[model samples]
Target: MGSGDGALNTPRWLRGIWVIPLAFLLVFLALPLVVLIIRTWSGDGWRILANASTWQITALATVQAVLSTVLSLAVGLPIAAVVSRYSFRGRALAQALVTVPFVMPTVVVALAFRSLLGSALPQGFLIVVLAHAYVNLAVVVRIVGSQWSQHDDRYARVAQTLGATPLTVFRTVTLPYLRSSIISSSVVVFIFSFTSLGIIVLLGDSSTRTLESQILRRTSVLLDFPAAAALAVLQLIVICIVIALGAVASRKRGQQKPVRNALLSMPTNRASRTAIHLIAVCSCAIVLLPVFALLIASVRSNSGLTTQWWTSINAIDSGTTRIGSPVASLAQSLQFALITGIVASLVGGCAALAVLAHRWGRFIALFAIIPLGISAATLGLGMLLAFGRPPVDLRASGLLIPLAHSLVAVPLVVAVIAPALRGIDPRAREVAATLGARPTRAFFTAYGPTLRTVMLAAGGLACAVSLGEFGAASFLARTGAPTVPIQIVRLLSRPGEQSYGVAAVMSLILIALTLVLVLVVDRLGRRNGALRPAH
Candidate 1:
C-alpha cells in the first residue's frame, strides 16, 4: 500500500471509531480546561501571576524537583541495572516491590514518610524531596529498565577490550543507549515532584511550597478560587515547558539500533553475582522500609506496641468531623475505583483502537495524553469550576470524582491497551473477511478476545489509580462522603495516637488494594501475550 492509501486502508468496522473517545475528551477534558481559562479571566485571577512569591515558589519547586529527579535516578538506576539486567534469584519480587510505592496513594506515601522519619527529619525541604524521590523510584526503574534490559552490553565489552576503562566505556557506550529512557523518566519525576501536593502538605514547611500546594491553600483555606486558578495556570505552564523540553531531548538521542539479545544470564563470578543480589536487597529495603515503619506505627503507642487501633478500626469514625468512617471511606474509594475502571477502559480503549481505524488517531491519542501534563490541582480546580455548581451540577451526584478519575486514568489505560492492540495481526481480520464474514464480525474475530483480556487488565489499572488518588479527590469530595485518601488526610490532621493509628491502618489497606490490582494487571498482560516482555 502507498502512503496515499491511509484511512481507506483500514477495515470498515474500525473506521470512525474515534468519535466516542473524542466526545469524552471534549466534554470532560477540554471543557474543564476551557472553564479554567474563563474562570481565571472573569475573576481577574491572572493578576496573581504578578506576585513575586509565586515566581519564588516556582524557582524553589524547580530546584526541589531537580534534586528529587537526581536522587531517584541515583537510587533507581542501580536497582534497574541489577533487576533488569541480571537473571538472579528474587529478581521478580525485586521488580514487583520496586513498583509498590509508585502505585500507592501520594497522601499515603506522605504519611509513611512522616511516620518513618518522625522527628528525626523536619517536615520541610529535605523530607519532602526524600518522599518525592521515594514515590518516583518506580518511574526511573521501569522507564530506564525497559531500555536498559534491551541495551547491548556487547558495546561496552567491545570498548573495554580496547584501551577504554570501565567508567569510560560506560560513559561512551552505555549512557547513550540509556539516555532516552533516562530523560523520559526524569521528566516524569520532575513533573510529579514539582506539582506535588500531598507530600508537600504533609511533610513540608514554608521552604517547600509548590504551586500545587499554593493552589490548594488559595482554594480551600483562603477561599480565593481566582488566585487558585491563577496558580493552576502557572503550574500548567511550567509542566508544559518541561514536557516539551523532555520531548526534544528524547528526540535528540542518537538513533537506537535494535539488538539481537537483550536479557543477560546470571553472572558466573562470585563477586558479580553477590553484587547483583546485594543491590536487589538494598532496593527492596529502600522501597519497603517506609511501609514497614507505617505498619509498626499502626500498632505501637505510648503503652508499648498496643493493638487498640486495630481493634478499634470498626468503631473509628471521622464522620463527626465531616468525613466518613474508615469503612465508609474505603467503600467510597472502592465505588469510585469501579466506576473509573469501567469508564476509563471504555473511553481509553476506544482511543487506542482509533489508531487502527483512522489517520486522525494520532491527534486523538495526543489529546488524551494532555491530562498527563496538567497537574491534579489544575484538574480538580477545573472540575470545581466547571461542574461543582450550576446549570450542570454533578457535585452531590457522586459521579464527579469518578469522572475526574476516569480522565486521569484514561492515559494509563491507553498506554496499557494500545500496544497490545497494535500487536494483533491484521491478517486475521483479512482471513475472516475472505471467509465472507461481515466487517464487524471480521474485526471481532481478530481483536475481540485480546480486547476482552486487556480491557480487564487496563480496568484493573484504572481501578488501582482511583483507589489511591488524593489531590483531585481532596478538591472535589463532599464533606460527608470523603474517599479513603481524603479520610486518611483528615484523620492525620487531628491530634492523638488514635488518629495516627487509624491513618496508618488505612494506608496499609490502600497499599493492599493497589498491589492486588497491579498484580492482577501483570497476570492479565502475560496471559494476553501482549507486547510486554515476559519474566
Candidate 2:
C-alpha cells in the first residue's frame, strides 16, 4: 500500500486530531476577527480609511520598510554566502548566533540598541531602520542561505575557467541562482518592518509611525477603537498584497533541479581566507555588541558598578510608579509560558497529524500558516474586541493572554512538527500492524519517537514566544500583572536611572531565558536525531 493508504488506515482516535486545531482556531482566531469586524461596522471605523494621515503614514512606512529590506540584504548576503557556501570551525555557532536577534523580543532589541548607542546616535528614522535590519538579519540569512547552500557552484567554476573574474561570475551567474530566495526574504523583511510595533514605539518619531503603532495609540492612548479597527484592516490588506506579490515573484521561475550537498572547502589563497575569517568575526561582533551593552547597562549605575538593579528585581517600588515589580512580572511570564507551551503544542501537533491523515491535509496546513501573515497588533486588537468585554468578557480571566500567545505560537509549532511527521516512513506502521498491534499502537510505533522530540521542541519554542511577546500581550495583559516585555516598555517610557537599570536587568533575564529555551530545543531535537548539522 502507498504511504497515503497507510496514513488513511490510522486509528479513529488518531484521525480526530484535526478537530482540536479546528476548534481552537475557530474560537480564538476566527471568532475574534469576526467580532472585530462587527464592532468596527457598528462604529465610525470606515471613515478613518479615507483619512489623508493614514495613507501618509502608510507611504512613509513603506519607504522605511523598503530601506530596511535593502540594508538587510546588503549586510546579510555576504554572511549568508560565507556560512552557506563554506563551512568552517564554529560555523554552527555562527548560524545560531545570526538567528538570535531574529527570535529576540522586539522590545528587547529596541532597548538594546538604545542602550548601545546612548547619546552617540539619536533615535529617528535612521536608527529605526537600522534596528529593523538588525532584527531581520536572520530571515535573509536563513531563507537565502538555504537556497544558496543547495546551489550548484559548478556554474561559477565554469565561468571562472572561461576567464570571468570573481565579481563578474557572481554578477552573471550566482545572482540569478539566488534571485528567488532574495526576493522572498526581502518581502518578509519588508512586511516585518512595515507592521513593526515594539521597535517603532521605542525608537520612532513622527516620521516612523507605522499603521501598527497608530493602532496601539488609538486603542490605548486615545480610546478610539473605531479608528484603530480601520487602520488594522488597512494594514492587513497591504500586507496581503505584499505577500501575494512576493509569492508570485518567487514562483516566476521554474523549480531548479535539486543538487546534492557540496562539500565545504577552505579558501586556497591567503587573501580569501583572511576575508572569510574577518567577515565571520565581524558578524559575531555585530550580533553580540548590543547584547553586551545591555548587560553592562544592567549593573552600571550613575555612581559605579553595583548589584542594585538585580537586587531590586523583587521590589515593588523601584523608583517608578508606572512599572510593577520585576519579580511579579517574571512569575506572570513563566505562568503564561507554561500555559502557552501546552496549548500550542497540543493544537499544532493535532494540526500536523491531520495533515498526515487527510486528503485535504495540504489545504489545512496552508490555512494554519495564515496567522504568520497577520500582524501581532492586529491579532491583539481582534482578541481585545472579541474577549475583552461584554458578552464574552475574558479580560480578567488568565486564559486571555495565553490564548493570544497560543495563536502566535501555533504557526511555529505547525512548521516544526509537520515536516518531521511527513518525513517518517509509513512502512514501520504496517510492520507493527502485521505483528498484531492495534492501529493506535502501530501509529505510535512508527511516529512516536519523532512526535515526542518535535512536541518538546515546539513546546519550548512556544514558551520562548510567550516570554518575549509584547504586541498581543500589550492589548491583553492587566495593569496589575504584566509580562516581562510589557514591564520593560513601561520602564523605558518613564524617565529615571533606576527604571532604566531595572529594565536592563529584566531584559538580560529575558535574553537568557530565551537562549536557554532555544538551546534546550536544539539539544532535544539533536538527541532525538531530528536535528543535524547543516552542510
Candidate 3:
C-alpha cells in the first residue's frame, strides 16, 4: 500500500544548510553566552554563585516555568486542535490573534492582565501562569497545529472502527502522532516562561521570580554585574539543555507519513465541526479580551465613556513632572519603535543573508539568536555597564532603548526569515544562472521577490517587538522620556485611580498599534503568497 508519498530523506546539498544554522548557533547563539559564562565564572562570580538565595530563586523560577508550561499546553492544545483541524469563518484571523500576546511586550501584557485581573487575583503564581499561558498560546497553536492539520484523520477513524472509543482512539493513535510537536512546543514555552522578565517584574512577587528577573535585580537594583552575569549564564545553560531535549524528542523517527487535507474537511460530523468552530471563536475571544478591555478602559471613564483619556493625554502633565502625559510616551515609543524597526531589520536581514551567502553564515545567524537565551535585563545591564559610561554614554543619545530593542529583535528576525529562506527552491537559482543570468541577477531572479516579502513581514514583526518591549527599556529609557510600557508600569506602580485609568488608556493604544502591525504584515504576506506554514 506504500505509494511513496512520504517526504524524502534529507538530500546532500540541503544537508549543508545545517552547517550554516550550526554556525549561527555558535556565533550569535553561543558566544555572548560563553562571554556571560566566563564573566560569571570568574573571580567574584563564585561568591554570588555560592549565595543560597540565588539557588532558591532558581528553584522557584523552575517551578514557575513548569506550571506556566503546563497551563499553556492545557489551554493552547484545545485551541490548536480546533483551529488547525477545522475550517470556519474568521479562522485565519483567529489564528493570527493567538499570536498577539506572544509578540506584545511582556510589560504591556502584564499591565493589561493587571488591569483585567490584578484587582481580583493580584500578583503571584496564578496570575503569572495565566499571563504566561496567554503569551505562549501561539507557540503551541502554530507549532502543534501545523502538525495536527497534516495528521491523517483516517488513522483515527480506523482506530475507532476497531472497537475503540473516541478517547481510546485519541490516546492510542492521535496523541502519539502529536507527541513530537507537543514536546517541541512545550520546550519553547518553558524557555519563554523561564526567562520571563517584564511580566514577572510588573505583575509578580517573590513567588513568581525568574532567573531573568533576578538577573535584572542583581544588575540594576543591586548593581552586582558579576552576579547578574552569572545568573544569565546559568539561565543560558538550562535553556540549551531544554532545547537539546526538544531537538532529540522532535527528530523524525518512525513517524507516520503526513496526510495533507483541505482545512475544511477534517472534522468528523456537523456537531464536531460546530464544536470546533465555537472553540476557535472562543479562543480568539480569549486572546483578544484583555486587549479589548484595554481599548475600553482607554475610552471609558467616570464621565460616562468619555475620550478624556485620549484627549487629555497631553494635558495630563501640563504643569507637573509627576506623571508625564501618556501621549508623550506614545510618541516616544513610536520613535523608538521606528528606529528599532530599521536597525533590527537591517542587522537581522544581513544576518539572514549571511546564512545564505557563506558556508559559515549559520554561525552568524546563531549568534543573533543568543539574545533570546540572555535575559533582557542582563542584556540591558551589560549594555549599560559597557556603554552607559563616561566615554560612551549612549543613554544621552536616546539610542539606548532602540539599540536594546534591536538586540532583542534581531533573534526574531532571524527566526522569521531563515525558515522562510529555507523553503525557497534553490533549483530556481541554478536555472536562472544556467540561462546566463549573472550571479547576483540569478540570485535575485530566483529568491529576490520572496526575500522582499519575508523581509517586510520580519521588519513589521521586529517593529511590533520593539513597541512591546519593556525589560530593556526599564534599564535604558531616559528618566523623563519613558516609553509607553515603561510609563504604564510607572503609572501602575503609583497609587491612584487616575493613574490606573491612564495606564489602561496607554495599554489600549499599544493593543491597537500591535494589531495594526500584525494585520499589515499578514496582509503583505498573503499578497505575496508567503503565508504558508514553515517546514
Candidate 4:
C-alpha cells in the first residue's frame, strides 16, 4: 500500500497539527533546560560537577535503583503471570488494584508507608527501597504482563513434554522470551527510583539521598542555583545513559516464529488452581494493605473513631499550619485537572495526528516523550528558572501548574492515541473521499469517532496525572493555593494527630479521584470500541 492509499495524503491543514505540539514542547520543555544550562554555566556549575559528593550520590542512587528494580521484579512477576495468563475471578479487579499504588501520588505512597511501617521499619535505605518497589509495581506488571499474555504457553508445554522441570523451563524458555520486556520495565522502574523526589524526601535519610533530592535541596534550601543546575545536568546524563542501555538491551536478535492467539483459561489441576488463586489474593492484599491503613488512620484518633477529619476538610483551621484547607486544595486540583486535560488532549492529539500526516511525524512522536525521561524535579527546577522570574513570570497567572502537568501528560496521551489512530484503516478515508468528500472531511469521517473516544480517555488520564503530580507542583504551586498532593505533603511534614488525620483524609480523597478518573477512561474507551485486543 502506498502512502496515499494506506496512509492519507497529507493535507496542508492536517500537517499543521504538528505546529502546536512543536511550539508547546519548544516553549515548555526545551527552553527551560536551555536556560538552566546557560544559567548554570555562567556560574560555578562545572565546579560542583567535579565535587566528590556529586559522583558519590550518583553511585549510591544507581545502586539503590538497581535494588529497587530487583525487588519490584521479584514481587511483580508472579502477580503478572497469574493475572495475565489465567482467567480467574476478579482478575480485572486484581489488575486494577495493582495499578492503584502506581497512580497514587508519590507523597501519599510515602505517607502510607510511614503510617503502615514507620514504627516497624526505620526511615532509611531499606524503607526507601521498599517504597520504590511499591510505587513501581505497575510498571512491571503492565509492561511484562502485556507481553506475557501474548506468549504462547505451547513452548512451555513442549519443553515440559521433553522432561524439563518447570523452573528449568522458565529459566531457559520463558525467561528468554520475556527478556526484552523485563529489561525495559526494569530500566523504567530504575529511572523512577533513581530520580525519586517525594518518596526519598519523606522516607530517605542521608544514606538514601538521590540526586533528585539533592537538586531540590540545592535549589530551594541552600539558594545555590549553580549547584542545583550541575546536579540536574549530571542526573540528566545518567538518565540518558540508562535509557540508551535499555534500548540496546531490548533490541531483538532474530525474527521469531509467530504464535497463535492463546486465550486465558483456569488451571485444571487442584494444586495449580489453588496456587494461582492464592497469588491473586495475596497480590490484592499486598496492594490494599497500606491503603487500608491510611483509611483507618483517617478515622481513628486518640479518643475514638470519628468523622471529624472528613467533616473538617473545608475548615480553614484544619490543624495544618503552613498548608491551606483541604477543600481549597481539592478545588485547585480539579481546576488544574480540567486545564491539563484540555491542553494535553489538544497538543497530544495533534502530535498523534502528525505521526500520520507529516513526513517527520514519527520523530515528533519520539520527541514528545522526552519528558518521561526527564525527572519531575528537573522539569520543575527548569521551569522555575525559565518562567518563575520577571521576564516571563507564570507563577501569578495560575497556568504554570497546569502547563507542567500537560507536559507530563502529553506523552501518555500520545501513547494511548497513536496506536488507536494507527489501528484505524486508512482505506476508510479513501472510501469517504471516493464519495466526493474533501480530504479533511474524509479524514474526520474515518477517524473522528476513534479520535473523540481516545481523546476523552487520554484527557481523563491526564486529569488523573494532574491530581497525583507533586514534584513540579511543589516548585510551582502558589503558597495560598496548594494542590491536594502538595497539601498532603505539607500536612505530613508537621507533627500532630489532627495533622496526620487531615492528611490521611486528603490522601483518601485523592485516591478516590484518581481511581474514578482511570475507571471512567477505561469505560469510555471500551464503550467507544477504541480498545482493541493485543496481538
Candidate 5:
C-alpha cells in the first residue's frame, strides 16, 4: 500500500505503544528483583558479599561454564555445519533431534548420564561439564547454525581459488562470519552452566557447586536469607556483565542480511563423505547414549532385564515409603506443565507485545531476560522468602512451582516473540487501516497470525522448560507434593539398586516428555514457516 493509504488507516494508539510492555516488566520482572534486593539490604548483605566462599563458588562456576561453552561449540559447530549447510536424507530430523538434550530436564539429563556413565566415570567436574555440554548443544547449533546457514560458501570457494589452504580459508572467512554467533552462543551457554542447579546438585561434588547452588543452600538448608540474597546479586551482576560483553561482541559484526535458504549438496569425494557420515553418526551416538542407558535401566531389574519398572509404574509405591506413587509424579508434573504453559504465555506474550508498543520496550525486553541470568535456586529462594511463609504460603496453594517456572519462562517467551514482532511489516497495519479496519483490528491484522503461532510455540517452550526444571522446583517443592524432578532427586538420595533403577525409569519418562514437547513446538513453528530458512 502507498504511504498515504497507510497514514489514513493508521490509528492514534500506535503513538503510545510503549505502555503495555513497560507495565509488564514492572510487575513481573522488576517487582520480584526489587523484593530480593530489599531483603538482602535489610540484613547485613555487604558482609555476605565479602565471604570468601562466595567468590570461590563464583570462580569455579565461571570455569565450569567456560569449559562447558567450549565443549558445546566444539560439538555443535560440526553438526550445525553439516545439517544447516549441507542437506542429507534425515537433515531435518537430525536438526530437530539435536535440540532434545537442551529441552530435557537437567535432572533427567544428569540421571541419564549416571545411568550411562556413572559406573565408568565419577560424578564431579568432568561429568558435570559433560552433562552441561550435552544440554547446551542446541543453543550453539540453533544460533550458530542460523548464521552458518547464511554464510556464503562462495567466499571460501573464492579463497580456495586464490590458493588459500582449506584451514586458512576457514580461519579467515568462515570463522569471522561466525564470530558473533559464537560469542553470543558462548555467553548463553556459559550463563546456563554457571547458574546450573539440577545437574550440579545431582552430578557434582563440592568443587562443582555454583552460586546458584550456594543460594539454595543458604535459603533452604541454612535459612540465611541475607546471604542468599547477596549471592543472588553477585550472580546477577556477573551475568549482566557477560551479556553486555556478548552484545558488544555481536555488535562488532554490524548488521547482517538474513540468509535465505540455500540448496544442500552432498560431499563429492568418498573420504569427505565418509568423514561427514562419521561425524554425524558419532554426534548422534554421543547424544543418545545416555538416554539409551536410562531407557535400559528403566526396564531392567535384579534378576535381569525386565519390564517390571514400566509395568509397576502404576503400583510402584503401593507398599513403600516413597514420597508418592511414581505414576502420581507424572500427573503432578503434567498439571504444573499446564499451569506454567498458560501463565508464561500470557505474561511473556504481554511482555513481548509491550516491547513493540513502547519506546522503553528494549529495556523491558532486557528485564524479561534477566531470569536467564538469575540461578533457578536463587529465584526459588527469593520466591520462598517472599511467598513461602504462613500468611502468603503459595506452596500449600500448589502455585509456587508453576509461578516460579513461569518466571523462568517469561524471558524465553519474550525472546521468541520480540524478534518475530520485529519481522512483521509495519505497513501491514497501515494497509489494514486504509481498508477501514479499526486501529486494534489493524494491529491484530498485521501481527495476529504470527503472534498466535509464536505464543503457542512459546507456551510449548515454556512447558518443556518447566517440565525439565529441577533446581527451582527443588527449592519450592513440598515434601509431600514433589514434582518429577524432586521425586528423581529424592530417589537418587536414597540407597539401593531398586531406588537407582526406579530413578532411571523416572529420568527416562522425563526425557521423553521433554522431547515430545520440543518436537511438537518445532513442528508448530515449521507449520507456520518459522523454521524455514531465513532470507
Candidate 6:
C-alpha cells in the first residue's frame, strides 16, 4: 500500500501477488462463463428458449419487476426525501434502519414478510410485489438520497417564486436534478426483482414466476440441465438489455451537481417539520415491523406465546428427518462466512492495491467487479458445471460456496478500499524516512492503519453477505449440508406451525449475526470516513 507518487512504487512482491486474484477470477469466473456457453450452445438448450412458456414467463417477470420498481420508488422517494434533506432527531438511525432490509438475506426477508403480512395479505402477486418493494427500499434511498442531499435547493425555490405549486416545483425542478440517480436506482431494483429467487419461491405464485425461479425448477426438479442453461442464457440477455438501456438513459440525462454540497437544512414551519418527522418515524416502522413480526412468530404458537421453538433449535432433529439439526446450518453458514471473509479480503485487497501499483491496474480492478453484473445463481450453476465434476470437485472440497461468494463480494470490497487507499497522504512515508524508518516501515506508516481498518471492514461485510446469501447456496448446498437460508426455505416449505416457528427462530439469529457484522463494518469504515456520506 502507498499513496500519490509513491502509489506506483509499491513493492514488487505486492504487484506479483496480484496474479492470485486474477487466477481466481479466471478459474471461477471466466471458466464458468466458458463452460456455461459450451453447455448452452452444444445441447438442445437453444431450442428450449424457443418454447412459448419461456417467453410467457419472461413477460410475466418483466411486468412484476416493473411494478416492484415503481412501488419501491414510490415508497423510497418519500423516505429518502425525509431522511436525506430534512435533518431531525434520530436521522442517522432512520437512515441505518432503511439499509437493514437491503442487507438482510432475501430468504429471511421472505419469511419475515410472511410473518408480518399473514392473513392481511396472501402470498401471491400483490404480496410478492410488496415484499420486493420493501426489500429494495434501500437501493433507492441510499442511491437517490445521496444525490438528493447534494443538489442545491435554490432551483426549487426559484421555481416556487415564479408561481409554481409545490408539486409543480418538484416535477419541474427537483425531479430533473435526480433523474440520473432515479434511473440508476430503478435499473438496480428492476434487475433484482426480475432475477429474484428466494422471495419468489416463498411468497410468489404462478403469476410471479421469474426466470431465476424457473432456472432452479428446470435444474433440480426436472433434472434438465440443458433447459436450465437455456434459461440462464435468456436471463443474461434480458439483464444486459436492461443495463444497456439504463446506460443509454443515464448517459443522455447525465448528472448535474451543485459546485459544492449545500449545507444540511431543516424545515422551518411546524407543519413541514411535523411531516418530515412523521415520515421518518413511519419509515422506521416499515423497516422494523417485519423483523418484529418474525420475532413474535418465533414465540407464538397454538397454546399462545410459547418458547418451544427457541428451545428446540439445538435438537438433533430440528428440521425434516433427513436434514439433521437446524443448528448445523448455522454452523455451516458461519464456517463458510469465515472462509469467504478471508478469501475475499485477500483477493479484493490485492486487486485494490494493484490499482495503485500496476500498469494494468485498472483492468484488474474492472475484472474483479465483473462478477457484480453476473447473477449469483448463474455463477453457482457455472461453478457446479466447472468444479463439481471429474476434472475438479470443489463441491467435495467444500470450497465452492466460499469461492463463489468471494467473487460475488470482491467488487464491494474493492469499492470500500480503493478510495480510502487513494486518500492516504504519500508525504507521511517521506516524513517516516526522515525519521530513519526503513522503506517497509515507512510504507506502513503511510498506509498501514488505514488499510488495516478498511480490510477488516470489507471482510466483515463479506462475512455478512455469505451468512444471508440464498441464491447460490440454494443451488450448491448439499441436501444434508444446507446453509441457514436454504434451511429456512426448507422449513417454510413444509406444513406446520412448528415449522414456521423454528424457521422464524433461525431467521432472527441470521439477522442478529448480519446486523452485528454490519455494525462492526460501520465502526471500522468510520475510521476512514467511508461509511457515512457527507451532507
The alpha-carbon lDDT assigned to residue 104 of candidate 4 equals 88
lDDT of 4 by residue, 1-535 (tens): 1234444444668867788899999999999999889988899988988888888888999999999999999999999999888887799899888988888889899989988998899999999999999999989999998888888888889999999999999998889888998999999999999999889888899989899999888887898998898889889999999999999988997523435445468878999999999999999998998999899889989999999888888894545555668898899999999999999999998998888887777778888989998999889999999999898999999999999999999999998899899989988888888898888888899999999899989999999999999888888888788999888878877888888999898998999999898888888878766553111
Candidate 6 lDDT (Cα, whole model)? 0.86
Model 3: per-residue Cα lDDT at residue 205? 89
lDDT of each: 0.87, 0.87, 0.76, 0.88, 0.80, 0.86
TM-score of 6: 0.95
**RMSD list, candidates in order:** 2.3, 2.2, 5.7, 2.3, 3.4, 2.3
TM-score of each: 0.96, 0.96, 0.87, 0.96, 0.91, 0.95
- TM-score of model 2 (CA atoms): 0.96
Model 6: which residue pairs collide?
A: none
Show the lowest summed lDDT stretch of 10 residues, model 2. Answer: 526-535
Return the lDDT, model 6, position 466: 94
Write one digit per residue (lDDT tens) for candidate 1, span 1-535.
Answer: 1113333345554676788999999988888889988888899798888989989999999999999999999999999998988887788999989988899899999999999997799889999999999999999999999888888777888898898997898798888888888999999999999999888888889999999999989989998998898889878888888989999888964655746547789879999888888899999998999999999988999889888887776678744656658988889899999999999999989998887777788678788878877888899989988999888889989999999999989988888888998899878877887798776777789889999998999899999989988888889999888898888888888999999999999999999999898889998888987734111
Query: In angstroms, how far off is 461's CA in candidate 3?
Result: 1.2
Ranking by lDDT: 4, 1, 2, 6, 5, 3
**Cα error of candidate 4 at position 367, Å:** 0.8
The list of candidate 1 runs beyond 4 A from truth reads 1-14, 318-321, 531-535
User: For candidate 6, which ten residues in a row score worst on lDDT?
Assistant: 1-10
Per-residue CA lDDT of model 2 for 433-524, tens digit only, reads 99998998998999998998899898999999999999899988888788999999988888888889999999999999999998888788
